[model samples]
Target: MNFEIVTELSHLERVCEQARKVPAVMLDTEFVRTRTLYPRLGLIQLYDGETLSLIDPIKLDDMSPLWALLTDESVIKVLHACSEDLEVFHHYSGVMPTPMVDTQIMAAFLGHGLSTGFAALVDEYLQVSLDKGEARTDWCARPLSDKQLEYAAADVFYLWPLYHLLAERVADAGWNEAVNQECNLLVSKRGKTPDPEKAYLDIKNAWQLRPQQLAVLKKLASWRLREARRRDLALNFVVKELHLWKMARFDIRSLDKMVDEGFDRFEVERHGSRLLRMVSELDTLPEEHYPEAIVRLVDMPGYKQMVKEIKDQTNAVAEQLGVVPEFVGSKKQIHQVLKWAWVNGRNPEKMPDLLSGWRKAYVEDRVLPLLK
Candidate 1:
């Protein structure tokens, strides 16, 4: 179990060259996202059967060698709960690891917990207890201690064994294709950049805003998204969501008024004029340019009963599958399905993730008929 810290370019190139020859590689990443829209990659941990290596992205200038190994579709990349890790890779190299296998998804198909943690899976299959104290460590900081290095190495060490165990169980259960298909979907989703125009939809109580106010919120959210990306700052650091909602809902005309309503001085000084201009222009926009108001399904008659029936059916399916109801289909996902089927004039084929791929056979069959 020898672990080598790779900080030089030649050493990384040699390691990646060796890793490319392996059938599979266990991988993990440590990143920080406290102040930026994208997570800043700090370290990469890799275990290619024989050698365990830690790559310091902070010290290395070029990671193209490692990225080449990651993008090699012929080699399998084994990871546990790899959503954020996939994001890190996409941000760094503009490419995602292909032929990837997520043990968490495999565990779900094998009748284990759907959102099982890495340490939990290790303890379950290999009887190893991992110290996760370094889970929140500032990996971007230099001069990492020996104990921290060991913890990072341990993250990917047991993944190799866990991948074997989970693959065997999933294959035995005849769910090999299902797990692979789901992991492919995970990779596809992680590679997509979100539409900044739709960021306002994520705001709480957004449905309560009027058509004109929704238009204002949309513009404000888009501006905030661009600013965050351009400056590499968190969205809140530019302008808090509460203030955005307040500006949209109320008739705050001037900077003084916004400051009186408790907007941050820095935000007021930076983007206050832009916000005011956007709000003022909302009135001049034509009626057709306004955003459509979000109609809550609960407000519609008989929709409550429809929601209850769908929840009961999803729960029954979860019970039949021996997994949690949330795992089968969360409440939010069910609502999205209903919105598509009823309001959006879309069919089950056009529905969201719940009715697609492997989920179609399990959940959609029971739920679609009721919606129709």
Candidate 2:
């Protein structure tokens, strides 16, 4: 029940050295980053049942030991819903935890699916209600209160036991092999930066736009992405989705027209004339210069049939497993699996890293067998 709070690098190193001797550790991170490019680690909690250590990354200048623990091939790193947490570790320490056991993934093996939030998992499995009132507390603030420390401690305190329970459940259900295979990949792969050329696909009007409009959309989207990364601002803060969709056509030749059309509401209004000029330049470029194939993916007639199959199969799979369908997989992933299947003439598992955990499960259980 006692947890040690470490605020200095020397203390953190000593704690990590001791932790490295252990077989496994339960880990959780509390960070503040809504306004920044990278999350600021406010608190990091690691527990090994008998001992708990809470690290203050703010006071600690060196975390190389903790990073070493993450990269240690022999020790298993345990977490729940580790995507953002993985990103945080990679950003700050330049290491992704290897040989991880994500309870979230194991929960899906028990049919809880991916939508099970952390508090909900604790409540359901551990029979404890969590105080999420401090969920949005600013982690970057100095002099973290006792309540904040308690909240942070709660995250990892139960993780050790939770992983034990889920590991057994997954093994009993004969899913450990599949799940471990995935965890290995998560541990080994370095996260890749998104390609700028494909960034426009995230735009709201990407699928609906014509080839010419898509070319313009790509240019503007690239500009927005670069600006957001350069200024370390949220994408919406630079330019809203509707504004980008409206400008995708780039038919408005004048800055005044854009202002009259509500583009002026953007905080980047001062850059209006300059942005208009950029769009105007894109307007002059040939549509052929853009990857017309990407826009064509959404319009292919085969996609409609794949959409229907994905919906029916996903729901049926969820029903068979006694879980909600959306948690099983998303419509977009379903489409991607089918598209990949068509080209590869093999299992959907052969698809690029685009397939999420849900897709992998669906492909292994349902789609692959049906393909035969």
Candidate 3:
């Protein structure tokens, strides 16, 4: 499609200039981040029908000018499945694109009744199937191949045409406002920070642990989270999850031997002794002195029954509405509902905020009736 690859800051400026002139730009990004908390912005592909610009951030110094064009209220940015990219751009540039359109979201709102994958959407609308075999290829690799360039170009190149179709469909179906609302929510950056106090709940074995065990688990989890942020490396790389959980149960006296057996060599090489000291300190603490916060939910009355009923009712409502059950209320919300009952008791009024918007209509009109 005659895509111009822009690897330097100078080329980025030209691309930004063209973007300022275009009414809207179709965009996509390719990144590598398996080793870090942040996705490495390797490639930024944009097309405005007349021009296709491939921006390589690896060689560019600052992308703030491009960020300005994106966040500029006058120009619109179009994307498909843009949630992750929104987060990445916001993290790097401190600004998120506004007045954006997400083709995938638009498709669903237009009563396509499914979140269509980009390739599937392209095939359905444009009658062309994108080659995604290169999707997982390490974008950080040097010397971009022609095949890779074509594949990358296809991402945004077809997107311009695809968005044209989706935008028309959304307008015809009178779903433009709904689609825009969804896009605005996606572009916001408020919910990215993980709350440390609630972090332990994400651990798989959280329910199995006693209060004392949970205290240690919480401490370990918070420590890992803080360390991952501090080092800018992936959490799993800091300390193997198995070793972290096991540390709650096992003392650190045998940590050296475990390290020798290839247990968290990264942690061992970097902060192994400090971790050992932390574990040793935890081991010496009295069980009664630890936070007794892990409440045994199974023993609570009506907990299991309420959970079963909530799930059944949520699925039934989703079926009736022809939407995914998760769109109604997630399983975690059901668990929280049960927890709420355990504490302040059930007030159907509070359930709406606890669930997704799709559930408000159902919970208010249907599911709450079943609860009573």
Candidate 4:
């Protein structure tokens, strides 16, 4: 339970220097992201199996030493469920840790199932229960409570032992290389912000819109995301998704119509005119310029049969490998592979995710031949 609070540059430099000597170090971050697009990093916990240090980024301005340590290839950075931690590090430092080992990935490969919580892993491997009460605390606030510090420290403290256990188990199972590649792929996928033009694709029920209506929805979705990023505000704070879809759906012209269509009164007042202008300007667009009506995969010919065949084969592979089916392939990933197979005027450069990285060995021989 004893840990050092590193708040000075010299202390951080010394800590990183010492950590560089280790073969691997446990790492974790505590941040707040209630409303903003980017996480506000609060504290960093690093444990080299000997020195458990809580480095306060709020106190230090120059984090070059820590950043260098993160990018060091000789030292593996071990983390549990590190998706957001990867985002926080990539956004804040502009670099991600290398030679990474995600304990969650190892656990999944070891048949614990994907999306396992860190506390759950710790309890199973280390026989210790973690207090998750501080999960919603304001991490950006100064003078973080001892309870908060203790909670954050616990994130990395148990990781050291758990990494050892899981790594050995994964290696003994002969899935170490797959685990490493999965970790690498995980790092590569972090921090990919979609372009504004394609932002509308993420809207739910967007496919129901007509071609011209889809065009208007695209414009609003683009503007909302652009404004959100520019102002660091949440997308809903700028304009609710319902507002965007409604503003585009029925082709509301007047501000009153907007409010009638369930647009928040404040949003209508603040953005109604701009939104109406975007829709009105589209009136001049040639019919050919409008986006094509979205074609849902379920509505496509042979989509259900293709999905069923692939899902069945994937399940067989997972059963043979003695792993969770989710670890083999999730529904989203199946859709990615199917969409790539279709190549119906989408990005030509994008490869099927199932045909790449660790997934390829499991999928290419067993399942993808069906697509052919």
Candidate 5:
């Protein structure tokens, strides 16, 4: 309940000035994300084991000091389940916190669970329960209540102690560098933008479409992503992904047909014609421009056998590594490895993340051979 609310640049500087001297800092952010493509930051919390400061992102004009402290190599920035926090930091600062330790990832390596909730870990480790009543409050709104501020401060209050406990286990297990590498890999993902042109490849059931239909899907998908970004709306808010797929599949030729098919009129009126027009232009394109048909990993012959072999080998390697198999190579990561080896086999220019970094350190000699 005791903390400083930093609203001015000078106050933020003062806090960051003191925080930089500490070897490590606990960090968290409160943001409101309703339907927009980006999270609107509201508050930032920092604990240097001495001062608990709630930096008012809404009132603070300059966050350079915060960025400097965050990127400071000497000071470890710690958080729990930092995927979203990483997004917030990357969005506003255009850079991620450095030498970050996601306590959630840390716990996963220590065998607590793959995705442990912060409160659950706190209770399990510290025997203290957290109040999460303000979890859904509008963080961007002014005049935050005492309860809200308390909730915010509670986020970073116990992080240092929690980090201390987890770090010791991680160090004993000799996974400190692994945790650090995983956090860095997570940060690297935020730096890349999703290519609108390839958006259709990610849509469900996209593999069912033929090359010509896939071309239409590609145009529709591209438009949807571009429009979503342009309007700052959630992807589905612009045009539902299913609708894009359906529109491509049916090739509905007119407004009446599009409406008759039950597409939302607002969307039909706003984007239907443009989408249809884009698809029509596809007819003029040469055959080579169409994306190659998507290859479904599940449909490949020997897919089941390959997966079983890989899973068995992964479990073996995971056992040797003394961590959860999912931590080394999750179900998703296994699929990525399969896809990389089979679907993109000819493209040696790329490699799956599972075969990179600390994961590679463990599984490359052991598992990469199995893929070959």
Candidate 6:
């Protein structure tokens, strides 16, 4: 339970030096992103088997020492449900921790369940309950309370033992290669800048729009993404998805029309003209330039039966392997596989993730046959 509250640069360097000697270090980050496009780091917690260090990112002027330790491949970095924590690290160091082991990923591979929360895993595996009272604390605020520090320390404290337990389970299951592949993919994907042009695909009810409208949606979504990042504001705060969908579906001639359609007054006043201009430019798009219609599988005649068959085969194979069907292939991934199959004349060259790597052995063998 002995820990240090590190607020100075010199102390952080000394702690990192000590941490380098450890084989593995448990890592966690406390950050806030309520009003910003990027997560604002507030605290970083590290437990290196012996010392639990609570490093205050808010007070520490430079995090280079800690960043070096995190990016060091010699020492394995351990985390639970690491996606967001990885993002926090990327925001600070512009790179993800290497040779990382995510207990959550290991838990899923070991039949613990998919996307299990950290607290739930701790309770289930170690029979230890974690206090989540400080879950919503303002991490960027100055002078963190003793209770907050204790809660933060607890996040990394159990991680060391949990990592060993999960590692043992993965080894027993003989899935070390598969688990390592997944962890590597997780770290590589962290801090990746998403394609703005593809942002339109995430809008709900987007499939209902025509090809021309889809083009407009793509442009509007791209604009929104750039604006959000440039202004460091939430995407929804800049312009809600609902408004985007409405704009794509309807013909709004002027800014006045946009306001009537439930667009925020300030947003309409600020960026309404640009949105309209983007939509207007889409009118000049060539016929071949328009985006393809997103045809839902259910709407495609006879494809519904194909989807069901694939799901049944996937589920049967998953059950036989003693794993969840979604773990083998999620519904979205199944749909993607089917879409690729249909588009490519039933060729299996570009199969989805479920049909690749270790998943192929469990899922593709059964599902691919159904697709044929």
The candidate that wins on lDDT is: 4
Q: Per-prediction TM-score, please?
A: 0.95, 0.85, 0.82, 0.95, 0.95, 0.92
99-173 in candidate 6: lDDT tens per residue? 888888888886767788888888988999999999999988988998898999999998888889889888988
User: Scored by Cα lDDT, where does model 2 land?
Assistant: 0.75
Q: Which one wins by lDDT: 3 or 5?
A: 5
Candidate 5 collision pairs: none
The local lDDT score (0 to 100) that residue 36 gets in candidate 1 is 92
Error of 1 at 114 (Å): 2.5
On residues 117-196, what C-alpha lDDT tens digit does candidate 2 reach at each position?
88888888899888988889998898888898888888898888788888888888778786776666555554556676
Candidate 3 on 1-372: residue-level lDDT in tens?
Answer: 799988778788888887888789988989888989778877889887788988888877888779888877888999888878887787788777777888887776654544568998899999998899998888878878999989999999999989998888778866676577667756653325787766667776666677777777777787888888888888888877766666665534565766755676667777777766665667667777776666666777676777787788877876765556664556767766666555647755554333434345556555556456
C-alpha lDDT score of every prediction, in listed order: 0.88, 0.75, 0.75, 0.89, 0.87, 0.86
In angstroms, the error of model 4 at 132 is: 2.2
Q: How should the candidates be ordered by lDDT, best one leading?
A: 4, 1, 5, 6, 2, 3
* Model 3 residue 297 lDDT score: 68
Pull out the clashing pairs in model 2. Answer: none
Candidate 5 deviant stretches above 4 angstroms: 320-322, 346-349
Candidate 6 RMSD to the correct structure:
2.1
Pick the winner on lDDT between candidates 3 and 4: 4
lDDT, model 4, position 248:
80
Lowest-lDDT window of 10 residues in candidate 3? 350-359
